[model samples]
Target: MRLSLAIAMAEEKVKEGGKNKMSDKKWFNKGAKAGKVEKREKLLKTYEKAIEVISKYAVTLFIKGFELSELGRHKKALKIYKKIIKLFPQLNVAWFYKGFELSKLGRHKKALKAYEKAIEIDPQYAEAWSNKGVALSELGRHKDALKAHKKAIEIDPKNALAYTNLGELFFKLGNLKKASENVEKALKIESDLVPALNLQGRIKIEEKAYDAASESFKQAMSLDGANPVHFLWDTYTNYLKIGFNLDSEDKKYQEEIATIIRNLEKMNETLSKNQKQEKEMRAYVLYFLGHFYLKSNDILTAKEKLEECIKLKSKSSIKASARELLGNIWNYRIKPPWWRWWLNSPLYRWPKRFGFSILLLLISALLLLHPFIPGWFPLLQINWSLYAFLIVLLIIILFLPNIKRIQIKGIEVELQSPPPYEPVLSPTVMEEIMKEIEAKYTKLE
Candidate 1:
């Protein structure tokens, strides 16, 4: 504080000593540099002096606001931007940045208004249009987002962000072919674009091309350094799904699992940086952690993480997924451990058959003892009646489709055969679900 005051006094002394041009320019540069370098205390001091020195300089104010937004001090940046907009109502850039800051704060409707104002001021502003599309997308106005992105592209044919946004818009709309085309165009223009790469990876995953999807995610990770843990979570979860084969003993599979766990540990460190205030983020991270642990056969850890996820944010899709996974965990662990322990035993493969035979024998013994019951003769008779019943049962078991069986640890566990149920939600469907959730939350807010 004393140093800043001393610097401010020295700067003022230089300004008053007949060095008007040099001092004014130097002070403005110093203030701008302070903002850029995130010297917040110094910047605030310089901000007060800058108003007195270059009171008419709108560019300096915009630079300050931009720097604040970059530093994630979005509400403060919004205040600066609002002041800029009030003073220079015709400045499209001010409105554009106000919208940018508002969008950063998740005020999509206000962002849309600010973006619309910027567009109204300058129809050819491709960046504003692209950002408007993002705001529209966040607001669940898919059609408007499409139009805004298209308008951005029309205004500037080579705008890579416009192309990427268009690709994401198409992805949300479930037109994977068009999504792929636009993302490819974006990559052609800017190959290292993280969002485009992530979107491309998502599209690959939807097509069940897990290897290709993983490669794309790897490329994205290379481009996007490891600071923000959210992207890491996405990459880790993709790897988990691809490498998750509960019964696999393959060397390659084991290596992939090891890599995923290592990545997850690093992500855990990243999450710790802001975990306290990020309840939803905690839920997301824990959900994936639970999923990875489950796939890695760490049932206890999986159950713990998933239950933590539910307790943190009980309303999200992450919570729903966590609950589903927890139910699966309980169902799996409740079964006799011996069933899994004897995975290498010869009878393990046909344990269900042996168990079924034992059950039938018990029934036959009961029927023989209770011959007075109706149909006891046919039920107890094994010469032809029982043989016919066994034949019919074998045919039905062999030919007729029943519940899907997942062979886990040598046990053919029968999965619930949902009656011709709709397929699992794809990324597009998940987008709609998220939109619904956000809308509900917005209404509550």
Candidate 2:
């Protein structure tokens, strides 16, 4: 009996030991899960901290850059923005603003590179694509410009600016139907859009749809008053050219110019006299006033107004028209000093600048290398053979196949299986693909 009792006690202890092992395993699994949760939370906190750290360092730099841009110190803005990009490579806004500042400075190629970098960082960046297209348009790469605009539209279907840009491109290409379609789409999205409305009116005028164009321009004027564009001036004058008592439309044109003159006076008065905007307003008003006088066949008042416009702002587009009109007068237009010869020999209009640059560079470089290379040897001696060799090498590189070639002669081939038949696209299918690619050329942004 004692032996049997002891055996039972041992069995109970073994069972208890097995339960304890299972409990320990469950506790361990729960601890592991808790540890993983803590690690994930820590990671989230670290990411937030990184973002905060970057923001603290980058935001002030961006602000300083913007202030520089506003001050018209574009080079400074570019440098600051570049620094921001280098310091915070993930900051797409810095790249974007840098491109904008470069565009303002007329550095289209550099602006394009900056915008491309921004787009590379964030492919869905609609503004970058639009601005890139603008730079391309300025560079006269219109087909590429259209592609970028369409790309922006693709990323954000609601982007009215992209549609307007596309419309302008189509208009320039003389695809009036497509232009109308796109501009109308932009207007439908934002009825108050003055630029699209104004352009639509211009296109209508070009198409000789007088009433339609007038309505379009009138709507544009209602939204944003008094543009300096000659289109608005010409549209008004054409309306005035309408013969009275003949067509009702003729009276309409005459009345429109009168209304435009009144609106111009209001626009000029509304602008502050102390501001630069005032100068632009005055220049435009005087230019249009001159146009009005010229239309009435009063050459003297036209000459006076145009000369006044010329004196107010040297950079106005109206300055060109003013110079043309004033050509019959004293004609003291600020003609280029080398105006006569510039057309014939543009490169030599100021050849001295280039000569001076070359001489200065040569002198500085020779001075630096005086101990090694004397001035005479540096100035007179030319390495013709080196240049020739470089040119020949470049020619060879251009003519050669771009792909790298490899030889497999030494490698043992598997004695072979039957060659598999590969299905390939036919000529017709390939042609279709080419056309598809051409279509994509319209929307590569």
Candidate 3:
């Protein structure tokens, strides 16, 4: 202790003697200042450590929120998203996710607001713009959706999703020409894109370009493999209906039917090979096969296929559509009523359509004669034979066609058959149908 004091005293004496009039803080004061500086540095380090830790935690939380959202637990997703926003208010993805979840909740206006907020943070956020447009489209604000979609395109011109959305908006607005153009452009830009291909298929179907439409659907199916339930059914129905109509034509009818048989056989083969087909898909295939048989005017095959569709998916929209189609089959197959022969009576087709011509002429002649010859005088002087002719003409012109449209449809088997046994046949036909229940009915193993 004595040596330490002597060294300190020596250091101070040398400093005082050598210094150019410099003063020193007291030793206790110097130590106190040093302690304060050390404390400040420690506080800064602590804050730095805290910020580093927070950044790591934020990323982890963000990922967990996304996972929850993707899993379709929207309430949990919303909670997690809100928490992330609370912790990191500037996160653009969190805002986007919140907007998307709000859209799922059907709060379109709130979704738009959330998307707008995301855009405010990052103006070039193309996905936010596209999502905002989707919400607007869902709300039936096609004009606003168009603008939002355009902005997304401007922000990211290469984004295929934005173009697909724009096409959908145009399609909703009934701007078919524009919708077709935009979706086609999107497909051109990204040929393998699923939604654009689907949209193209939808547009083609609307335009009745059946072959082109079929190709587009196949493309989408190839890309996505298993289509969503409604989409698959709709595409299948369209193909069936179009094929039926086109095959009804005189030329190439046989070829078209042959193609249908080949395709259905191939589809059946694929389904039988343990493919993972959905119930809705199986129902649709069966239903369309029923239609295929119905188009060929095969009652037994059609009946079997229709019943099989009901068996596989007994309680679904497919069942309802099949019922409607089955009813139509009976409706179109009706025979002409007996009253049709008398009503059609040849007069309606030949004279009724142009009978007004003769009446107009007669009225004109009467009017010309009436100025000189009073109306009463003409009736008194008219020959009894001419009066009879006018009477017969009146009966032939007006009443014949009217009688037919009301009572006479046509002459066919449906009119003679026992009350359409479609429903009753279901029980009895179940055994017969069991034979033709294409292996496709078994869900892919």
Clashes (backbone N, CA, C under 3 Å), per candidate, total 0, 2, 5
Ranking by TM-score: 1, 2, 3
Predicted candidate 3 versus true structure: per-residue lDDT over 1-445, tens digit per residue: 2112223433453444323222223422333444454665654544444345445555666777677655546677777778778857898888998887777666889889889999999999998999899888888887788899999999999888888889988877778999988887887789988778767876776676766777777776777664432244244545455555864665566566555755665565555454343455566667767766766667667767776676665444668767665555533343223344233322233453355556556656654564465455755565656755776555544344233333235643222333443433232233233223311221100
Give candidate 1 misplaced runs (Cα > 4 Å): 1-64, 67-73, 227-255, 273-282, 307-445
Q: How accurate is candidate 1 locally (lDDT)?
A: 0.66
Best lDDT among the predictions, by candidate number: 1
Output the better candidate (1/3) by TM-score. Answer: 1
Predicted candidate 1, C-alpha RMSD: 15.3
Worst 10 residues of 2 by lDDT: 436-445
For each of the candidates, the C-alpha root-mean-square deviation to the true structure, in angstroms, is 15.3, 25.5, 22.2
What TM-score, over all chains together, does every model reach?
Answer: 0.57, 0.53, 0.51
lDDT of 2 at 51: 44
Candidate 1 on 290-310: residue-level lDDT in tens? 766765667778778777787
Global local distance difference test of model 2:
0.60
CA lDDT, every model vs. true structure: 0.66, 0.60, 0.62
Better of 1 and 3 by lDDT: 1
